[model samples]
Target: MQKKVNWGILGLGQIAHKFVADLKLIPNATLHAVASTSGERAQNFAAQYDAVHYYGSYEEMMKCPDIDVVYIASRHPRHHENTLLCLKHKIPVLCEKPFAMNGVEVEEMIAASKSNQTFLMEALWTRFLPTTKKVLELIDDDVIGEITGVKADFGFKAKFDESGRLYNQNEGGGALLDIGIYPIFLALLLLGKPEEIKAIASIGKTNVDETCHMLFKYSNNRIANLHASILNETATEAFIYGTKGVIRINSRFHESTSVTLLLNDKEPKDIFFEFLGFGYRYEAEAVMEYLSKDVIEHPLMPHSFSVDLMELLDRVRKEAGIFYPTYDRV
Candidate 1:
């Protein structure tokens, strides 16, 4: 018989609900507990998800002996402390992306995980998607030949809510840290770090970037054009161009399940991915699998990848002259 991996959710938010719905999709994965600031919300979520336990405070959930791992779904500013608290309690952590505002905080989180000998992984769901893996394989097989350029964008015309998370600098809100990371992740995953990064942003009234456009130049002469914005709407598509042909990832590429390949004078080939519950199941499955094997970090989306990605974000923010006021608060 296999031992079940019981999961404890530290914040009951939008993402937490999706993760809980997917928990039942994994074998031997149980929604053991959920925590929220409101006791009513925590109890309701527990009942809705069939969790065996629920707590009004994160500290209370951390002390639950039934939970094998803790998933931190708190806001960007709270990830570091939430993770550290879990680590000290000997619980592994799977933290949501924009990992912790910046790389310095990420380093400290990594250190805590190491010191406690508990597992910790940045919960970047894109890297674990079936579509993402297929896209990578196609590139590796030179399906499009020598890569020359890449273009991707993620944006939406978000309503003006200065106090809300998206536009509020005090809450670590900005286009670059929120949506720009998706495009940057694609570039780095496909082309590695670039020699030159040219970026500019439109700083909105709240002082956070409303839009950001980035250009990366590699030593191999390859270039990537990436854009992100919360002030305007975009197609949210990603395209890869090469010497032989091109490959296009359909709308909302970051969370998309379809990819199309085009070869010279040939009809386009489309590949589709089918997965469980909001497509977050794949990453959750990866975490459970690692825990069952007594492993610390996921090989596919390792700590180094998280660190490097944050380093890139840090550099991009610097170039764009965008800084969040939440850094000091975190």
Candidate 2:
């Protein structure tokens, strides 16, 4: 039998709860430890998740032995620091996305991973989803002929709260970095880096982009139109256009379980996938597999990819004028 991979999670936020629940779905993955700034919250989270250990402070958690990897589920601004802490202790890390506030921090994180010889991956869960695999397969097989354009959007109505993470500039709040990343990820995956990016955003009272619209023009004449918003609810679907037809990712495309294929002079077909948990298990499983192989990075979501993604985000922020004073170095 394969040895189980012991997991540690930093931060006790909502995303952390969802991630731990998915960890249960992987047979070889076990929740060994959890840590939070609040001692009571850490203890409570540990109890709820049945973690073997819990630490009130992140620094203390780093000292725990036999933790195969640590998931940095902290807020956007903390990702760089949290990841560096794990790498400093030679602990592998799977950090939540928008990997860091900007490209410079991402580069530093990559450098740390290289210097420490430890595994590191940006937890862009959508990249590992079954639906994504199918979409890629279809594109590769020319189910949709030579791709020409892509259009995707993700949005939700968020109540304005000046102090909440979603609207607070200090917390890295903004639709572009929060929900907008989904559309951006899809475009980058399908279209590569845009040669020229044209973007504009609606900056809210809290100094964060409430809505962001991006147009990416590629050298090969391919184009991508992407949008992200926290002010209104959108279809949240993704459409990949090609010379022959289009592949439509169903609503809430980021976590979508189904996709529809529309071919020229053919019928529209819907593809569906069934899975346990909230779809985070796939990335966790991938990390464990890479760790077993003694690899330092995930091929599907490599450090280079994270670097490129962050750099692209920096460009978009520059164009949109979205700045987080505490974290923005670009």
What is every candidate's alpha-carbon RMSD to the true fold? 1.6, 0.7
Question: In terms of TM-score, how similar is model 1 to the real structure?
Answer: 0.96
Model 1's alpha-carbon lDDT is 0.89
For model 1, residues 1-330, the per-residue Cα lDDT tens digits are 667889999888888988877877887888998998889999999999899999999989887887888889988888989999999988999999888888999999999888888899998898888889998899899889999999999999999997788888977788988899999999988888989999999999989999999999997899999999999899999999988899898889999889989888999999988966788889888888898777778898888888988888888888888887658422
Worst 10 residues of 2 by lDDT: 303-312
Give stretches of model 2 more than 4 Å off: none
Q: Best by lDDT, which number?
A: 2
lDDT of 2: 0.94
CA lDDT scores, all candidates in order? 0.89, 0.94
Candidate 1, pairs of clashing residues: none
Model 2 Cα displacement at 168 (Å)?
0.3
Give the residue spans of candidate 1 off by over 4 A. Answer: 328-330
